[model samples]
Target: MTDQLSQLKQLTTVVADTGDFASIAQYQPEDATTNPSLILKTIEQSQYQHLATEALQFAASTLANGTQAQRIALAADKLAVLIGHQLMQQVPGYVSTEVDARLSFNSMATIEKAHQLLDLYQQQGADTSRVLIKVAATWEGIQAARVLEQQGIRCNLTLIFSFAQARASAEASAFLISPFVGRILDWYKKQQPDADFSGAQDPGVQFVRKVYQYFKQHRYPTIVMGASFRNTEEIRQLAGCDRLTISPNLLAELADSHQPVIRQLHADVPFIEVPGALTEAEFRWQMLEDPMATDKLLEGIRQFAADQQKLEELLKAV
Candidate 1:
């Protein structure tokens, strides 16, 4: 068998889930994605400082002189587009640039920020199809995506854990939803250290599989992109998914190994509809009741928001 990376690509659309352009270019993933956390990771290195510098300069030049908060907001928007623009050069398909996680619960704010990010991408001479404005899978976020989709803006809903989030995203006509695998496993392992979650038995894998089946069964066009994977087994379990976005480290592992990775999840008969799409109350109640989903969702948002603040701090220092 050729390297697992190449073989897997035959069954699925492999996306590089990183902000590092060099690694993405080397792997040649079909698409590339970046969140506030990932973009902050890339900007930490001195070699990537120029991208930040460029964004700050762009912000200072284009944005009106405003309060410190306003300046930070402008700078963060620029940084997201700066990274996405660069990633677009490397990947042949779309580049996902996330909205500020701080606005995850604010539908109007999320829509506004998505436009700002998309505007920056367009200003860089890139088409709309080349970009995915990533938002959280909150009802507000999905609602924001619904409005954006009507206006021709595509969205990738992140931090999606439950099928409620998945169904709402699909109903919102989201372009994609990144169901986090590693983070799910992290939550399960912390809660149940004795449980065996290896391979197909993993909660994260099972969630993605069910969501994928639900989408394919119902003929929903929303794409399932399994993300935040922990190991090769998780990736292998989701081999035939619509897409799998792996980190550079995992991409390298797949590239180096010649494992004859076989497809696992397939479009079987779609299960019966779980229920109607979630209303805001239902969504909130479900999230509140599901401990793992609620905790991971909250944790992911806080971590991303923290990274956004750190990115702003970096802008201030430089």
Candidate 2:
């Protein structure tokens, strides 16, 4: 009998959500996703620091003619691109590299930073189609994605927690959206005393399911990629999602287990009302109305920013 992981792969594209390329190669996921936090964690203990050192040296040589601070920023961005380039060589599909989280709310800055990362890839002769510039799902970020999409720059709108965020991303015609599963489950569990949620009723599972149904009903081209699973059950619940970006730890568990797996989500279900585009004010108000979305989005950005800084500090120290 095939393990659950192999069976799940037959139903949906399995993306390894980590910066550790060795394990990524071990699983041979269709694609691989990386975030500020994962990159920081991986590079700290990974044998891949040589890649960062080489990128920093390249920045110092050809990337000269910038202020000291500007030089540091260039080095950091180069590190991210180099990492993405290496991972792209490993996976069959795209590798996601996130924009600076501090620019999460700034559309213009995010747009500029995004192309800058692509330019690095362009210079190295890496295929742009194998890259996804990850942006926070802020209204400004989604607007940034809209412009980038027009220029043929694909985007992965991430840190999503609510239907509003997902809807806005799809309206912007993003390449994909990563709705967090563990974080949503954490919020609801924190609120209730007994925390009885489980199976399909799990808040995180239900949230993604609702978004999946909404997209299927609308027939939107934007793909839904479930992310941040706290346990294997969440992964099992979302078996037939468009994609799932899973951690290496959970991937190892799925690789070992032969548990029964089945498609839990089907896009051909009864169609629901499709929501149209959201105005800037409407998007902000919707986030304000949903405390869980607001808190989780804020926390997610802060955590990413902090980890990026830590990665920067580590790079600088070397």
lDDT of each: 0.89, 0.90
* Candidate 2: residue 117 lDDT (0-100): 93
**Candidate 1: segments with Cα more than 4 A from true spot:** 268-275
- What's model 1's lDDT at 48? 89
Sum up the clashes in candidate 1.
Answer: 0
Best by TM-score: 2
lDDT (tens digit, per residue) of candidate 1 on 77-195: 88888888888888889889888899988999999888888777788898778788899998888999999999998899999998789888998899899999999999989989999
Report the Cα lDDT for candidate 1: 0.89
Give a tens-digit lDDT track for model 2, residues 1-318: 899999999988999999888899899999988888887877787587887788778778865876666666788888888888889889999899999999999999999999999999998789998899999999999999999999999999999998889999999999999999999999998899596888888899999998998889888889999999999999999999999999999999999999889999997876667665788888889999999999999999999999888877887888
Q: What's each prediction's TM-score? A: 0.96, 0.97
Query: What TM-score does candidate 1 reach?
Result: 0.96
Cα misplacement distance, residue 52 of candidate 1 (Å): 1.6
